[model samples]
Target: MMYDVLIAPFVEFEFMRRALAGVLTLALGGAPVGVFLMLRRMSLVGDAMAHAILPGAAIGFLLSGLNLIAMTVGGLIAGFTVAILAGLVARMTELKEDASLAAFYLFSLALGVTIVSIRGTNIDLLHVLFGNVLALDDQTLLAIAINATVTMIVLALIWRPLVMECVDPLFLRSVSRAGAPAHLAFLALVVINLVNGFHALGTLLAVGLMVLPAGIARFWARDISTMMMVAVAAAIVSGYAGLVLSFFTKVPPGPAIILVTAFVYLASLLFGPVSGLLRQMFPGRHLEA
Candidate 1:
């Protein structure tokens, strides 16, 4: 039963193997980014940024007809542009970063959808929105892998300052100029990872793998390092379970994977050890001398 349920899918089908690889790679690279975003209180910003990548992707699709490289490049460009522009708006105007990002993302999402609708069919748009993980080709998988590798490397390099900035932004800024650069680098990593996931999970669903794992991890961990590990583990498990569910039920892999992660998030909310509902409702026994 286990073989038929889990092993057989990957053993029997090459696409299943590729899908598994794609999502697992995403889990390793994107999950930590999600953790940082959560720590920095930018969870909604991640969602905005995910939508921000859509215009570039749509333009890429309009020009190249679903070419992976084109869309990836387009997404990177759009994501970076929006991030920079929003930062500038926040810095130069009265608006805050979150509000600026929210406005830009909404505009970008609408623009992207319009561009795609202009030249592509509804099926093409659906593909952009929901992604087609089971259809990932060798080239797309390679791109995702490369993106993941870059994300990890850059993340490691900027770890300390970034964490400092997240924990105490004013203190970090007072101490060193690394704050701004680290912030930019972190945003770049976020964009890159989102673009990476875009190929396999679509623009709308891409952020799920990135953010949901972090949300689940928060209930289980207190420190950043442990939280990141837990997030990655949760993402991988969710990805695997989601893929298997999609295989048997014939549902879309992207949504299925995200839904599984969401379920885990809910469960963690209810039963996780660190800050679960059960723990809150029923405190542990303590002994006093």
Candidate 2:
């Protein structure tokens, strides 16, 4: 009976299958973006953009009445718009990028909450924050698959130049067009993935999943490529484990999955065996030498 509750849902129900597929796609799409976000020092920017998607999603829900595609597109536009506006503001003012990001996300969160209060129920608000992954429909699953596939392809194509730009933007700028095209392309992919994953994980945990696994990978891995691979693997394992746990516990999958990933992150931080927190703190002890 315990196994039935834990594993049967995934094997037996269509909704569970869709939910798993959606999460797997999100994990893949987000892991690479997280690595790049870390490399570019734009991790907070991703968080802000995720929150910035909320108002647009609420508006889309009000206008179209639960049309997933329309809502996803609305959220994507809002997220990308905020990102671009923040960039412009950063260039125009003396404020740093982090400051600009904070402003954008705060504004977006306030606006989203206001709109949802006026137009939606408390459940709607909860959905925006935490999501309902077990209720994900076929349409959403299909969209997730498509978005993940395209995002992966685009990332593969531009990975080198984007990495170069992230590592040394000044040097790249001195060379040619400075990989601006690649940068733009990567940002576009980020928007798509954020929107695609929004309904499955919500803004708060979406950003968490995006950043934590990549961060954990950074502690144990030296090379960029290896770090990315490790991040993706970590994300996939944690996501699946979380989903299965949620199935058995009859809990909300989004937070459950995030908690699992968070545990993995904590483990990596505490005992990663290379530059883990314990090793760093002790300085004389070696977990694996």
Candidate 3:
């Protein structure tokens, strides 16, 4: 019965196998980026960036009708443009970074919707907004895999300076010139992952696999490296369980996966070891000083 429930689906179906592979690669790149976003207190920026890519994706869809490369390039361009513009706006104006990002996010979302409406059907818009993971093709899968590889490699290259920037931006800037470049590289990584995610999870829900696992990891881990590991594991489990749930229940695969992460996040909130409600409610014995 367990085999029928768990193992049979992947073995019996190619789509299931493809979905699993796509999500595995997604998790590999996204989870660590998420952990760093949380560490830097920029979780919402991830969401903003997710929205920021939409207009470019919509434009790609308009121009080429769902070509993965076109949409990915569009998203990358749009994401980078907004990131840079928002930074400039914040630096030059009275508006804060968050406000600048929020403003651009709204504009991007509105523009994306308009462009999608201009040339695409409701179904196309739905597909763009909420991805269909079960529909991932070989080209899409390959793109996702390549994106994950690049994200992992770039992250490794920028790990030290990025971490230092996250922990102490001022100290990093004071001590080394790597700070600004590291920040830009990190932002580019975020954009790249979100662009790839747009293909698998759509623009709206793409940030789920990225940010949610990181949030869950916070409950169990106090260190960055351990938090990233936990987040990746959580993303993997959520991806598998979500696919299984979708198979049995007929829920949309993309949303199903994100909902599973949400459930896990709630569970972690209540029962996790670090700062969960249970830990707070039932305090441990104080250590003797």
Best by lDDT: 3
Q: List the residue pairs that clash in candidate 3.
A: none
Mind giving the per-residue lDDT tens digits that candidate 1 earns over 141-245? 898888889999998899999889878999998999999888888889899999988888899998999999999999999989999999999999999999999
TM-score-based ranking: 3, 1, 2
lDDT of 2 at 1: 90
Q: How large is the C-alpha RMSD of every model relative to the true structure?
A: 1.0, 2.7, 1.0
Model 2 residue 289 lDDT score: 62
Candidate 1 weakest ten by summed lDDT: 180-189
Q: Which ten residues in a row have the lowest lDDT in candidate 3?
A: 165-174
Give the residue spans of candidate 1 off by over 4 A.
287-289
User: Which scores higher on lDDT, 1 or 3?
Assistant: 3
Count the clashes in each prediction. 0, 0, 0
Q: Write one digit per residue (lDDT tens) for candidate 3, span 132-208.
A: 89999999999999889999999999999988987888898889998878888999999999998898899999999
lDDT of 1: 0.93
- Per-candidate TM equals 0.97, 0.92, 0.98
